[model samples]
Target: MDPSEVEFLGEKQLVSIVPNFSFGIIHLISGSVGPFRAGLPVKVPIWLAISLKQQQKCRIIAQEWMDIEKLNDSIEAEKRSKLFTKMPSNHFMDEAQMLLMVAPDDIPDADNIRTAVKDIWDLRMSKLRSSVIGFVKNAGTYAKLDHLTAMEINSIRSLLPDALDIMLHMEHGGKPTVLQSLNTTM
Candidate 1:
């Protein structure tokens, strides 16, 4: 899936919001949100929270994982791990991007949080790239990618599958089908 699609999924994750207006439970196909009260925080989907924030009807509460200290810890852990480490949220990157972009004023340490998240992302991506290069060079039949987030997997979707296909063809004593296809075209 593309980044936007991943973000769409991420938006479904619940976030805290304190609405200025009271409202009854919002019945949605996915699930139901609470009967909102003015000035009292309630949990709602990120999309709805963002919408309300944009409309000046509510304040968005940042997720716990959005904290700079926690994020920095995660970054250091990721740097130490050889394999992909578990993320605080399945959609951490997208969630951070959306919330930070929409309600920077609402979340404390927004600038530093953004920087920390970027650092974690960059570190993970660097590891992923190195793994991919090693996998390709070693002609690996398959590789375990535990704890990879959807966005991370999608980043390599276009390249890895095709490379694996070519490698599989070559490994089975057949000429690379990709090269054969190109030769035929020429």
Candidate 2:
């Protein structure tokens, strides 16, 4: 899947916002938003929160897991763990990117949080690459991807399948068998 597609999924995650204006609950296909009152926090999808933030109608309350201290700890844990560690959110990277981009002013220590998140991502990606290499070398049919986040999995979506197909072809002595079809019948 494309990064944009992953981001679209991430946009569905709920976030807190303190709207400056009052409004009744806005119904959406996903669910009802809220009867937003001035200066009161309400949970809404990231997409709507971003929209409201862009329009200067509300201040986005950063996700609880977005705290700099928490992020730093997560980075340390990821560095120490050999296997993929559980992330605060399934779409943590995308959510952080969107929230930081839209409302950096509202989130405390935005720069530090960004750096910490990047560190964690880099560490995880490095580990994932090493694991993939080992898996391919061992000719393993299955892998346990317990704690890998959506973005991480999507990153390898294209490469892994193609690599496996190549391995299969090699195993079959590179013959064009029934599994391999020609472009078109002449």
Off by over 4 Å in 1: 173-186
**Stretches of candidate 2 exceeding 4 Å from the true structure:** 177-180
lDDT of 2 at 140: 74
lDDT of 1: 0.90
Ten-residue stretch with the least lDDT total in model 2? 177-186
Q: Tens digits of per-residue lDDT for model 1 on 1-186?
A: 678998999999989988999989989998999799999999999999999999999999999898888888898899888888999888888999999999999999999999999999899999999999999999887888888887899899999988988778867899556678898899
Predicted candidate 2 versus true structure: per-residue lDDT over 1-186, tens digit per residue: 789999999999999999999999989888999999999999999999999999999999999998888888888888888888899899999999999999999999999999988898999999999999999999876888998889999999999878987898889799876555654543
Model 2, global lDDT: 0.92
- Candidates in order, TM-scores: namely 0.91, 0.95
Q: Please list the C-alpha lDDT of all candidates, in the order they appear.
A: 0.90, 0.92
- Clash count per candidate: 0, 0
Q: Distance from true position, residue 114, model 1, in Å?
A: 0.2
